[model samples]
Target: MSFRKRSEVVNTRGPGLQNARGPTQDSIQNARGIPANTRGMPVNARSPVPARGPQLNTSRGRNVPSLNNNNPSFRGRLSQRMSNMNINDDSNSHLNNHPGIRPSPATSQLTTSTGCNDLDSLLGHMGLPLGNSLLIEEIGTTDFNSVLCKLFASQGIIHNRLKNGNSQQESNTHVIVLSLNKMWGKELPGTYKGSKKDIKKQNIANEQSKISVSNLNEQSSTPSRYKDLKIAWRYGLKDEIGQKNSKSTNQDSTEYKDYNHQFDITSRLIPTPTSDEITYIPTNIPVSSILTQLTNAIDKNPTKLIRIIIPSLMHPSMYSPNYFKLTEIIPLLHGIKSIIKQNESRCVLLASCFTNLLQSSISSSKLLLNQIQSIFDSIVLLEPFQQEMIQLLEKSYKTQPNKIQHGLIHILKLPAFSEKGEMCVSRSEYAFRNGRKNFEIEEWGIPVEDVEEDENKDNNVDSSASNIGNPNNKPKKSTKVDLEF
Candidate 1:
């Protein structure tokens, strides 16, 4: 805020002299020796002149601070103070204060839930990676796969409304549902609280383990005779130490364990009055316009996370099967891919398409899907069981009364940037069942009957023959029985 005054040049010479060298006007007048052509003006008007400001001054063309002057150090110190400040830190803090906005995950953990806890773990990252797109391919006409989409949207809504420890609600994240269908928001899946039966079973299992350990300790410590009192004391002491260790471990697991959330499809996840987390965009709008709108929505809350759900994308019922052709779908998905990469910290994209529609024309579908899959960071295919696969499942889980909805979770692509080896990949079948509460997923064992394929084939052949009856043997005599009215 302070300004330094310019150094004044003192004119100490006599009036007739100009700085002890050049002739003054009085000297010129007295001499009468100046020519009219060059009397009042210098020869070159463009010549450089000394600066009149308080900045560094030099006799040569450029200003160089004199080494004797201490002012240069003061200027250097001022610049150093400015450089030490972080502009990003100030801008980030300002953006974070906007209601419903969140800071980018660049410095924090870059993961969010895929909504389904089981699916999240399966995807790796134990949640969806921020700024990546996930493609879900559901085989056949069954829209059961759409349930995953709903859970994704519902989970986002729940995450957006969560309040911090200080009881202040942060800016909610936005969910945009892009689809051709109109049934989106009507039946969004509700939040899932874990089942009471499952919780009780886990508790019971933990109790049983504790009992078995206690019994083993008791058997090992039993004394053969009262003479071994010292040995008995030692055994008792070991038993007590082992019990304490087990109890401490159990306590730790109970206190710090994190659980996956399951959502109910019977109801919807209602948004708060102040924030509308879900926005349904109709596919009728041009894709260009859709992108524009999406850009605007993201700009509205640049600091917050955004979840984009494109349900039943390119479904034949919604759009013609030909639309999935490379000429069309590729460019569209490419645009989306660019957007995802550009705003990676704040946005995530999820798209689903019925795998059956793509398979209608095998070669083209395969080619198209392969290309489309390349655009996404993760790709998952849910294939319903083949007849043989179904039979094997039935034979394996027959003892268990609960009907297991059978499907193969073909992980076409694992979660983003996972470097895990194929040996570590999970081949566990995705077993799920719809209940009053919500859909639940569990790791299903590979059917044991797989090793007995030949045996199963023989059994199937015999059953077919019995059902068809003997073709070679002659006809049986019909017994005519009369029924009285």
Candidate 2:
């Protein structure tokens, strides 16, 4: 075979049978010129590039290129934009400085006190929010729920008095009581003052302190001239210090007026509310007339905070048997609810019902109660202690009278109008004591003595049985000999 370089090899085939070769400069130039340039210019000639059309922005039409090129962190730019925006949107403008209303510690919504600090705490909001209704259902015939209604009414009147401060003009808080009782104003509780014994103890303590100071002064001997000279200066210093302390204490007390006040059930509201501050509506009237009157009250006091108190709801004394019909009661309540919703910032409703009166055997009565409870934003069921439970409590708290509980409080449902939509029903058993000075709610628990007795009994039995296992313990020998088999 003849040795020949692959590059110089020639084929004897037709002219089309050529070997593949690398691109030459002339071939590359021809390939580049194949596409016609309508501008009729040389490829290498410099020409002004046509201005680019607006780019199709896929990122919601944002300037993504600039954003990405300038700052890699999008969150930083977002924070900068947020910093320049107004944070106070003022959606709750009506909540600002409204009398008798305070922002809830839990939800931060505008709320008013229910006149009982413990009851307020039980509601989980620390107070009752405006535009919502609270239905208190009691099982017994005792009128303990009526006491709460009075407190609710009195709180409104007191708030009105405090707001206007001796002004004869109409008050800013209006209390509308749905009852025919003319002496309702006189029945409201007054602010609590400590018992005589407590006051006496305080006075005695003060006297003792003064006596000790006087003794200390007497024990020290000083020159008469110096003593006389320093007495005025010392008094002057004391007076200055006292004035400063008083100013500080006064400032602290006035910093935020208490949202709830402690009331004494034994005393009546002094200088009862004026006619302008409270309105009594008759519940015996037709439901339509009641709705009309409610509407008129709301309309008349457009600028005031109205507190509606419906005490003893569905009681035979307050309402006729015909009023119990679902058609009549439902529309009445729905109307009141609508009014509250319309003036959410300035209205609140509190009503009490007797669950014992509702016949469970009758489906309609049971349904009526359920529907009424559903209408309210919150439902609290109060079950009074039975005779047996009462005896136990009395015996347990014989020495500590103040610790005795009168009834059990069941939080069936709490208001769910907050932005978080949180609904909480307290599962833990809670006991309530309706005291003369306050209505207290506390965690329910068995007495310590009872628990101790139970533990002692178990321990005694265990100790006796455990002695059998002890190696140190000896068993008694039988006196009589066993019979021989």
Candidate 3:
């Protein structure tokens, strides 16, 4: 028996074995051409795994998965489960804290005063809701809306200072001002001193505290009424007294204070060198960089509340008349909305835009403004106060003669989550004025002429009585007041 070298020998005993070898050789021959370009590759190299579905060999087509396919891998399933788990956990935690905070569809439950009580009353949230944007839209060419923006900024500053115990040092919050141009800095609203109403309320609360202290002392000295005291010395009478004393001391030392202020638009906020509370950013900065800088500033002070005041959002100086045409506005607003939601606990945004700018744009692109407006939590349109309405308001309210009438506060939209979010409510109209010391919003009342009509009827009877009492009952001739040349 002669045995050949193992590499050269080919075993063929049964026909079945030869049949298997025939198929193997054919498969080898089919794969050999695939790696022809892959020089130095081993002939015994493993074949590529087959694709799940039949594939076409189109030159431009890629070997991607089918469009309507599911990822059934273990890793994919695990990631999906993790995302669902996280969502459920977040929902459960939010529901747990639901009692403490009321959820708003349009705005956050948290709110800060607009610094003007009347304006607060007009808003559904009773103030500027946090984590929401307040849009101030003006119809005409007046800087009155700017005054509201200033007041909003000033209030935040004042509240921050007051929160820090009115310290002359640094404040506890940040005020970011996106000024349309250089003029806004010179005209920033000033911090308001306590108004007469604020002072009066403070005094009343103080008086009540004193009275309560006196009453507590009197009660302590009167002695316990229970005669069946099992442990007069050990019944915790001493502990109770000590607890009360400690509570009183704590109350006295750290009384809660309200930081809501009434801002004065006529004066400028006195910039203190040490207190860098207000940060001014030029509106001309690139839209992409705006949010980045804002994020950096906010992160710098993680614990501080943030107030962003954007005045004249699309002013001609900062942007072209056709600025909305640029795609940047959409992303900019979306980014801002995201930021506000992320920091809803301590962030508030107040922005103003002139309606005329949108109106003058091509009618087809008008929806851009609406889309922008929709992103905001609330919208307030300031129409030029009707001259007749202003006169009527002036006559009815009898405000100071020198007070310049502001604008009509038309609440176009209220925060969806607010207490009274209805937009159909009657006479949501309000008249605002820039007084010497304050910016005020008041209910727009019916004209005084109507009220005078009833008074005139009463006066007719008085006139008849006067005539009856006097000897001259004859009516006086009508006198023409108009003089013609």
Q: Pick the candidate with the highest TM-score.
A: 2
User: Worst 10-residue stretch by lDDT in candidate 2?
Assistant: 23-32
Q: Tell me the tens digit of each residue's lDDT in model 3 across 309-351.
A: 8888877777655356647677877887798788777678898
Worst 10 residues of 1 by lDDT: 98-107
Per-residue error (Å), model 2, residue 144: 1.5
lDDT tens digits, residues 48-73, model 1?
45566786436669766445536888
Give the TM-score of each candidate.
0.58, 0.64, 0.56
lDDT for model 2: 0.77
Q: What's model 2's TM-score? A: 0.64
Model 1: residues with Cα > 4 Å off, grouped in runs:
1-86, 89-109, 193-260, 270-275, 320-322, 361-363, 387-399, 403-405, 418-444, 448-485
Residue pairs that clash (backbone atoms under 3 angstroms), model 3: 104-417
lDDT of each: 0.66, 0.77, 0.66
| Candidate number that wins on lDDT, 1 or 2 | 2
Name the regions of candidate 2 deviating beyond 4 angstroms. 1-95, 163-170, 197-255, 360-363, 417-423, 450-485
